[model samples]
Target: MKGYFQKKKMIEEIDKRIIRELQGDIPLEKSPFAVIAGRIGISEEELLKRAKSYLDKGYMRKFGAILLHREAGFKANGMGVWDVPAGDVQRVGEIMASFSEVSHCYERPSFADWPYNLFTMIHSESEDGCHEIAERISRATGIKRYKLLFSTKEFKKTSMEYF
Candidate 1:
């Protein structure tokens, strides 16, 4: 099967190198991109320009930071899944995504055994906090048929390396 990137515009060698550098751990410095550009033998301005170009051309969907929630006192991680009606999925998903506690929210295909169509990744300081956030989301959306699956252990959490 063809991957998503296989259908997108082909990138140059420099772009591949830039993506490789970007996929790795960015330096904890004042000018991280500058450091990356320096290593890649490109000016910081050019790096930013190309990155913005990628966004504009839909080569990249978004550029965002990966938060280390565990070290940041987010001890509880919950996956809140909702059985939303097909007609109301969009509206309810928007409401669920509005919650500050919710980090990620998206619609997924529902199965016969598992009827949840909406899923939200919630982070909190405690398990009770997660429950409270879920309850708030439920009240806001008025969708009571939901489940909060807490994470007991995280085996892996990493961004995809395109290059």
Candidate 2:
């Protein structure tokens, strides 16, 4: 908290302007940052530089979409953990990514007791749909050792507000 506050304090007036402008949707035109820069009376290069600086200083985690799964009819969300062998981890991960239901997949470190290493997030309209996708991934990867963890409650999701 102290570090974040200190960093927040370091932001200059121009950085605040950039942050405020970026809080809304960037333009969809060819040069979106250029348009933003023009609106803020700064060059495109400076806008890009300041944006990169903001990210490096941990002010922004990422610039990406925040999917509303519930609103999109994907009410069920499950994180499927697979205990894949070290040599087969990448291959299994690729196979898991082929499924549209698998929104996000990655290889994570495993603990001594918890050997699950490959984690894949499955989102669907129903729990059964998620389970079906997990089963399909397991069968396709030939790795039967896996578990699907379903969410018991839903929480609202939102992006950061740095105005």
Candidate 3:
């Protein structure tokens, strides 16, 4: 599917390099952009302008930190899948997204064995906390049929690096 921007050609080589560099850890300093600009052989003003332009043009979403949920005391990362009625998928998704506990929520195609169309990622301190959140979601959305799949093991968890 095409992205919101759908303007890949608008991104120049320098922008691609800047994006690649951003994929790594941004400096923890008063002037992080200056540090990045220095490394990329560009003026800080130009870097700031380009970054702002990216956001303005929908080339970039939001720039923010990716917290380590486990380290942050969120021990359980539950995938809550709901068998929401076909006509109410969008409404259910919006309701799910309104919950602070739900970091990600969207609609997905259902399979023969699996009947869930709406899914949410719930992070909490324990399995019980996850279940409580799920229950609350059920009460809010009026979707009784749901499943909470807690992660047994997280092989790898990191933000996608786009170069």
Candidate 4:
């Protein structure tokens, strides 16, 4: 029983290390996984297997790239807030999220003063483009009561580290 607990602890530690390694920027190289595996003192195949296991076991929800929009020439971003009905939020959010211009879409709690419940992050090359994207989303969702809040400045943007 003591031996089993010790093995489990070691496994948990390795998983934590993997998560820590993954939380940072991935190497931009031909064999990025190989590089990461080498840092973790594991073979590339073993790293992939463990990563797959993490996904299969629901330990990790998703592994996806975070595009730096500014570097990619998407300079303007707008927070499109919609006053969507409670019953229609899910359907409308799906429609809004379908647009390539939209990067993030979710429903948030509405305040008495601020009734906009659904929000989407639309990105484009210019502020006008963002507004146009918001207009398209409004047309698709048929939710006319909306506003685009453009960012004046970005202080920081980074992914969360759970490890």
lDDT of each: 0.89, 0.88, 0.88, 0.87
lDDT of 1 by residue, 1-163 (tens): 6644566656678999998887788898999999999999999999999989888977777777767888889999999999999999989988888888898999999999999999999989999999999999999999999999998887988788886
Off by over 4 Å in 2: 1-20, 26-39, 43-65, 160-163
Model 2, 1-163: lDDT tens per residue? 4767456587578888999898779888999999999999999999999899878877777877766778889899999999999999889889999898887899999999999999999988999999898888888999998999998975855666775
lDDT of 3 by residue, 37-140 (tens): 99999999998898888778767777778787778898998999999888988888999999999999989999989999988999899999999999999999
- Write down the worst ten-residue block by lDDT for model 4: 1-10
Give the local distance difference test score of model 4: 0.87
Candidate 4: regions farther than 4 A off:
1-11, 28-30, 56-65
Which prediction has the highest TM-score against the true structure?
3
Residue 55 displacement (Å), model 2: 14
**For model 4, how does the per-residue alpha-carbon lDDT over 1-163 read when each residue is reduced to its tens digit?**
3543256665577777888898787899999989999999989998899889878866677887878888999999999899999999889989988998888999999999999999899999999999888888888889999999999998998788876
Q: What value does the lDDT take at residue 18 in candidate 2?
A: 94
Output the TM-score of candidate 4. Answer: 0.83
Clashing residue pairs in candidate 4 are: none
Stretches of candidate 3 exceeding 4 Å from the true structure: 4-8
Candidate 1 deviant stretches above 4 angstroms: 1-10, 29-31, 55-65
Among all windows of 10 consecutive residues in model 3, the one with the lowest summed lDDT is 2-11
Candidate 2 vs candidate 4: the lDDT winner is: 2
How does model 1 fare in lDDT? Answer: 0.89
